[model samples]
Target: MQSTAKAGPSHESVVTNGNGNGGAKSTPPTQRTALILYGSETGNAADLAAELASLTTRLHFRTTCQDLDSVSLRDLLKPTLIIFVVSTTGQGEFPQNARLFWRRLCSSALKAASLRKVRFVSFGLGDSSYPRYNVAHRMLCARMLQLGAGEVFERGEGNEQHPEGHSAGFREWIVGLREKIMQSFPLAEGVTPIADDVFLEPEWKLELATTDGTNGVMEGNVLPLRVANGHKSEPSSAAFSSKLDGTTGVVPNEDILPVKGAFTARLLSNKRLTAPDHFQDVRLLDLQLEEPYDYYPGAVAVVYPKNFPADVQDFIDLMKWQNFADKPLNVISTASKQLSPSPLRHLDLTHTHLTLRWLLENVLDIMSIPRRSFFASLAHFVGTATEDEAYQRERLLELANPELIDELWDYTTRPKRTILEVMMDFTMLKIPFEYVLTVLPMIKGRQFSIASGGAQRLDEGGSSMRVELLVAIADPPSPIIKYRRRYGVCTRYISSLQPGQQITIGLQPGYLDVKAEEMSVPILMIGPGTGVAPMRSMIHQRLAWARSMGLRTAGKRLEGDVLLFGCRSESADYFFKDEWHDLVEREGLTVWTAFSRPQTSTNAGVAGATDGDRTATRKQYVQDKIHEHASRVHEMLVKQNGKVYVCGSSGNMPKSVREAIADVFVECGASMAREQAEAYVDVMERDGRYKQETW
Candidate 1:
């Protein structure tokens, strides 16, 4: 069932009112109906709700999943089960997609009455390293119970980040919920197969024109192109093929221009920072932007990445689908819903172009592994089926069953294994392609905290900005795949590019939630590793502003600024060592370091050579350092009136630091209430005094 009403009693109804005047509608009389309400960020929760509807429909139960914003309180009370799946984004808040739904679900008025008949189950998806891990899911469960909603199943939480093993806690928990439902609800009688199909067709008006004046290609229309065999790097033509055979496709446009005059920069310098003896290889990069691409010192430059040729080839080897090593194949949304739309939309077909090899290596996530069900499905087709395996056929059931597949690619029955190599063995693996394509989200661009305000220009008429970025080197321990040893996409791509390499990319201005004026407010920056990129820019801007105003104090006295950086060592992996020192010695800046494996006084001169006795100890990490200087950090915030910023891995150090700050607030003044302390934390975040950008 579908409802588009945005508000009022009719908006809350399941059945339309008899009046043709377009007014309130009456829902079916009180009956044994099931409501599948969802709060999703990237639609994961909604997808689950749909799947649940499918399952419920098979049991002959009426089901509906509605956006929380459009749902009425009366509708919620009628649900036999309320399942919620939500993701925690930036600062433990609701995902942007779920914000509106969450706001109404927790409204002050809804908490007043009992929702006694609602038998609900909630599953939350969150990264453990975040400070407010699973906070949204927890909030909904608590609120629902407070409203007297009956709990058929206890709330379940899943962690996306598990340093040691695959994180499928949520998936596992969900299986248990399914079993519980089967046991509780008897079959309603001879049930019909779930509707032929059930997926929302979100409307996209063509009025939102593309840069180039054309109706972007429709699905099923084939566009063939010839391209050279090379990496998905610049200079190589990147193209793919698709057909209009009952599918959707995004027409290829010669130009999808980014913002006008987007910043153009030169590769000032690049150098490897890691010691030759170390297993890992890291680099320090410096770039100089030309013209009006000026920056506000604290901003970061977003580098576009290209795939390595060798890695791309390996991925092609695994897919074994086609020698797309050279020839591009027709790509389509292998997705199920496009069939219904007579004139399929552009997105129904993803912009799937380029050779299968290019798609696997550069476009598709190579690191992801095939779902166990993918293996089970192929079992019947490839003649690889055994009597035991034949007993159970569904891919979903096999995936949940847990009989592991040996050699991940063997399951796919494909010649090569790109998915297993890229997303999984390198470190971790997301679900299979079907799941990723069906359940997960797309890979998004990384946002860096901008670092520098450009120095004054010779011509007073134009302006430009400077940005700093920390190059990230990735080296996954893989004896199986040698290509896994290279650096990451974005950072590695930037590191290899030459001075004159012109590139096309996008820039997302700061959400405007955080902004600072020149020379007016002091900023405290706490970033380790690449997180320091923006801090460097901020420091540069502060200095430029001071220089522009001619304010130079003797003991670094003008504006308040503090920078904390963490790394493996000082000599080898420390980024921008000299640049940071220059900011201090030459430009009067203060920079601090938290070396996790810094060379102790006794371990000096341990470079360029490997001594068997050269053992490094783990010193304090960024979080510990934060705790060590909590009092001073607090004084800087409360007394010095400074802002706090953080960047880096979202899972660990960032959460630790925030928790440490909370601890500091409590210890320094016990009299301050807990909510008051939380308020302070919130204040810092809301004001950009406390800000973060984590992966």
Candidate 2:
């Protein structure tokens, strides 16, 4: 978690066409090397670049894995082959490094015929769940072609769900790239050939002795422990009052259980952000962290969330565990060999010195639905029920589908079914954590946009950074008993904290270039609802930096900042409105507010505002506003060397805005829909004109 890598060089230096000493272009020193340029937000693309670099070195190709911002267009064009591995940030925007790189690439000078010798291949990574899946890679690939770069092979595009997981797809792609590279560029002397058949699996294992007795039976891969009455809601404590169900449970004091090292922080303040009339609950969290924690303006912090104690207790009751809390048991692991070691053991069912409740919440996923194999393992239990084959088939079908299983588990069948019930149903088997892990996505941290500048200060001692975080306290509509809409894990934790309560958190380094020193740089921020966290931070940084420079926040021709903020109702959810006014009045800021719900034809409200005799219209969504200012945005990005930043939901708003921009390009003129849209976004990206951070 503690990163020691030096901060990268200035963005201008990497994108500059000519050195200050001479008007002549400064070509890179490593002419024979290949540059692996990665535009990654979550480090996956970077990891892929590192893997490729390690493999390419064996091919005698001196390679360097670089962030896109570290190299200029000259360096890119000079490389024999530049591998662009990029993932699309929110709203189809480029990742931080790629944004800067793309902006510069789109500059008139770089796009001219003077540099048409670039040869490149791209591999884009994205999830299929989103509509614009792999859109970033498509954009980069098109830009390379438009700028006269030759392609060595078909672009490699990998989805989140690839080949029963990633290993197979990754191995295949790397092998293909290796073969293509070998075929294109003859092997130099003394270069060794890599083995064609390398098994791609994590290299680690653990051995533990199995426990015996009526406590539990070590079935196939999982241990089947006994349970009382089989009701999930019955607390493990109550179930064990008369008889031992043979399982154990543990309760944690604080919400967070530090796994690795936790990032310590001081929760400066917390206030209810939403109105009392609103059904949803939200909060404005202000925290101050120590210095040397540099972050970009539009970056997200990944927070690890813990399950509620009530839910943990429910899992315990079903397992029928006891007070074996501090007892010792073997912990195992089964991760791939080439990867870094995971926090927990692999294959071992028994965890050491940890309570049953602790294991269910912090370790095992208790909410995981029973898999098909699990029912198959419990086949013997079916003997107690009716022997009708139709009944068995119905039960099997129910286990396979989550929707059906949830209905039965919540309403008709109920949590009364335990491991013993499984014995009465189908097969009895031991379930591996790996198989279980797949049932639910990793419990990831909610990424909030860093709104303040890293270079700002609060009290003389603490560094000031603004974060615009969404605190969603609404429950989802689900048929499953457990899936009932409840306050989100992190949101409720944040909402419940008192002003004086010190909260612990980690500062994930920012990716966008919103440093304190760059206060004079023009920035255009678009954030709807709570997505404005990082934008607030960036604006705050700019204000603080401007104050330090003894410069007025506004009036002078200082770098202009524009904010396009959207919400449901201006009255109920206009978050940070007063603070925004203070920023504009004290520091010369401009804000554009969009209220979609209230201003709709169905619910008209709010008066129009006038600026220099020009009256602004009633509210609309952010995407419509973006189109209205499309000409200005094009000018800002293409001419004035400004940056465009977006932060918001992972759903519709961002997607619409991107599509609107793509339509603007089509209106002007471009080849295919995908190509032109890609080119335009790529232009903004390569030149540092765009940055996006969203959940």
Candidate 3:
């Protein structure tokens, strides 16, 4: 829908971008505004919220959409319609982007009447497999209600395991929401809501400076270059440092990272885990913290990764944004909402002169797979004049259509097609430089489980502590684009690093909540592929506990710590295989392995192979091993109340593992029904006896 609201100020008048020209925001205020705040980890919740925001705009309401942390508590006090779409993250914790907002909401100073004028509704995205499922959505709703916000409709919950997935539930929820909006706040007579096919105006508007020779694409020195190891190094100093006031000057690298409490670390080791012929390349990275830092078992390190310089330049050239590449442009939020902690974020964007090249190279996520909202936005950029253009634009619109979700997934998500790849596919598509922020997603940090800590983490010199990460490089061939590959942007950045290279990393608390004091309780760990990282950390932590408990001589197996590790081949992807024998004999650790594809040359690598290990015949998976060791699992879980932790990729493995555990409960329990077995597993999850830290 075309906005009838009068422009309040020039683009330059608002925006307190660190640039010398920016000042306090001076745009129009909210009137009949619909605030849609989302908290997402995997971008699903944010994408859904963005889609709803566009729909709300089409319904003739002023819409403001952003992440939960971006807006202040005062914004919630506004007398307006509010909608929250939040995704539950690790355990029951709020997503990292939404933690600050959750903390603020928990303030004792907030009165019950603070949100008296706010009418709101909530939608949750979660997995039913989790005990504290949908906690993020539930917590927000309950808190808002306590603050006197009126509920306009019952909350809608989206389960990831639903037959059609979370998006299916959102499809149904949005349909009901549209009806509620019409009933609650009817549009004025003779004014109609925008058609479903129409595209809303971009929330962000960029104003270009006068076009001149100097403003066009600057060659070579657009970015500073330095040599390392007798070759040109990647932009490290100024790439992370942007002069927001638009100056091409270097600033102190003190605040190189946007996240608070981040520390610099140097790469000490980057060793490949898999064989050279392996389809996937896995690396075991050891990083030495330049400053002292502490993290517990299952803790994660969030690394901020940059795009490959060549890819960034390719994106600029592809868009024909040469003239605007080096030119500094002014950005203004045309809407009430300004993204702060989202992909469309305010981290380094504000501090720089805001050149197109700078945005691509340092800020934007050009390699991320475009969500459905991206296609909807892309539909606005291309024209439909010629037959070829019409077909391309029509297809983009089709992908954006709410009814064609399956088609959209088939075209984009399943193929893992990146934004740059999408643009390349549509030969006629060229988005305006001003709309780049709105079209492109921001470069978010990648989290890898800290694989090293405890005894191994501390150097023998007692001078340095190291944190390790097991990163599986993603560079698989694309199904749709046969000629191109799907190289993960963050993984690519990580793969290129050399020893002694410095980088900033953020630390995250783990959900396992394991304590060193729990020395008597046994623990069951199931880790496959790179998921073994966390399990490795826990083992190191257990070793430290053994030393502190004065049981070092016979301590490793004192608590009966068991790790059920799985991989495809013993000599190919079996991470940490060499250490198993030493751990079994010296540490008293029990290790079980499942090799889906065994090597023809030798047996599966179990240092002290038991009868069960020797008898394995055909291909086997982790879940199969769990079932084979059902009695032991039942003993540790039910009889002893030991904690069981599952760490792996999200797809079908977690669900299968949960089922295998439940099956064990059924087998062990006296006359236990299937329902009773499932219920018992649920209880274990509720009691925190069972925990999963999957992607």
Candidate 4:
């Protein structure tokens, strides 16, 4: 989606003496305003920011909520207290929406004390499993501090690894958050914060199309939907007939998305990379673009998957919304009585049209486990006609209570109960049809790293522009529920694709940032499993560059390039094995293989020159292999001024791999003190010499 708005000059610029006016107490609570900005790859951070806005509003502060991309560093110069809610995506890079603002914040044009009066506290939503956990928020906080912005409170981190998930840490932070902000702008005389149970109006409101508004309302307290030269317009059913696909509204074709630019890609092939007997199912997809696309190894392909028809029908039946499922409703901004654009205008809907079933099937996520916020919101919508219904509503409210955290986990997370299942269980909960948009989270497009890129990655045979992806299917059987597997919405859809099937996709600039590097710059690559995808792309392109310069294919060809590949066995999941061997033999690229699942360790067999380890006694991972070859790794990194590119799962793999690299400096070549070695790596990361692309 595009940025909603541009950053204008500050309304009330306040220059402070580094510590005084950032959170100036002159303004009363009612006059005090808070600006909440979020950088969310998924809907998590945005949703959290919205909740925070609601809570802050109840405290008698006028609050404004927006995405980071919608504003700039200049916007922070205002006297208003700002709160940043950011999430790191794709190798610890800023999410797409936040990138522009982040770049502006980091620009060297501004003086060190540029944001001296910008008062803010930041909260990061992240998974600690990755090595660069909460790096985006941490960096933003550090940058703001460096630029002399006053911290209204110490920053907070919400780790998904917590037993109670992100909410656990959030609850703790929010307790301090409320207190901290309230202290900064104390409640006016005899005023107290509104009770938590008190209902607050939603930010967005829904209005049915009346006879006078059938063509779509454009004035007087209603949201205006404009097209072309900004002529006032509003949502109408005809918008659906012209723009949205029939029935599902998520059909895979042109005009499906990207009001600005979107293209179709036909599936050239969808081959399973993993062996049939292997427990994990992985597929290699080859998609040929209808338009000529740029070749970038680390770029991402954004895809939106459709929900299964059966699941959508089940949810409709549970909600008892079949009768009006097809009717369109105009969503107006409750907070902005003035004109505001609908978020989906980018979908080419001249006027927005939302049908209940159409939204459920194409826009709302019903398969993922429901968060506690879902329970809290749904409890307000329940109808307690009978004694059983009253008990169910009470149960829903109880689950929302922070005191019963474990109980909430059991009822939702542990069983992985989805929205549909929750609706089935709490039959008394009947959310009004118009309020569905506010209750349900928005569906976000999933991004998969492009596997194929470079000069040799294209076919000029007048057919298609090619991009590839290595995807692993997620369909494990549910632990508590039988007869159904926990299938991931996007991955499952990807696995069902057939050759020649065209789907809508957008190419996103990958975070790899390797394309501009010189061919002679050495690269130490560490990739296990499908992480090899980007590495393969870079290697081929590097080799192609060397060839273009008429250099020898061996030692002179992108000299010191090395790839450390780890997998279960040489026989299975040794993805692109033959290609690696060929590159080693012909292009002077060093390739190391670590096979973990073999029963016993096997000899090098080849004098430790060509093929890497044959087998390991116990399970050997990429980190283990990094240690064995630490000297060579240190030589490439320290002596040759090389770069390191690591790609893999965001789980413990990235953290373990990073620690192993740190160990290499102390134990192998550099032999510096532990702290110094870590500092060195940190410097490399800051300088962009060390990069990771873990999902």
Model 2: per-residue Cα lDDT over 1-695, one tens digit each: 11111233211211222211111232232223467889977556765675665455445444556778878877765556668888876656677557888888777765445346666677888754344578888987887777777787788877664522322345457668877877666544553443211111112221222333123232223222222233212222222323211212222234334444345455567777889988666776666653345555555555545544545554444333333322223223332112222324221222122334445545443433333323432231222234564466456546533234354444323333333234333332222222223222223344565545534434445544434344555433444335233334455445545444434455555556555544545777888888777677777666656666776634432346777788887678877777765655554566777777653343222222101123234657988766777766555554556777777675566667667666655544434466766687767766556666555
Q: Candidates sorted by TM-score, descending order?
A: 4, 3, 1, 2
Task: State model 4's lDDT.
Answer: 0.71
Which is the winner by TM-score between candidate 1 and candidate 2?
1
Which model scores highest in lDDT? Answer: 3
Q: How does residue 597 of candidate 1 score in lDDT?
A: 77
Candidate 3 lDDT, 83-195, residue by residue in tens: 89999987788887799999999999988898777788889999876657898889989999999878887899998877557877787778888888777766556656666
Residue 42 error, candidate 1, Å:
9.1
**Candidate 3 similarity to native, TM-score:** 0.82
**After superposition, which runs of candidate 2 have C-alpha atoms over 4 Å from their true positions?**
1-252, 290-292, 323-326, 333-353, 367-442, 454-468, 479-489, 498-504, 515-521, 549-559, 599-619, 659-681
lDDT leaderboard ranking: 3, 4, 2, 1
lDDT of 1 at 615: 46
lDDT of 2 at 60: 44
User: Measured by TM-score, how close is model 1 to the native structure?
Assistant: 0.61
Alpha-carbon local distance difference test for all models = 0.49, 0.52, 0.72, 0.71
Give lDDT tens digits, candidate 4, residues 72-154. Answer: 67668753678899998755889878999999998999888998878888899988876578889999999999999888898
Give the residue spans of candidate 3 off by over 4 A.
1-30, 69-77, 99-117, 128-132, 142-150, 157-168, 194-203, 207-261, 333-353, 384-388, 551-559, 600-603, 609-615, 670-674
Worst 10 residues of 2 by lDDT: 14-23
Better structure of 2 and 4 per TM-score? 4
Error of 3 at 50 (Å): 3.2
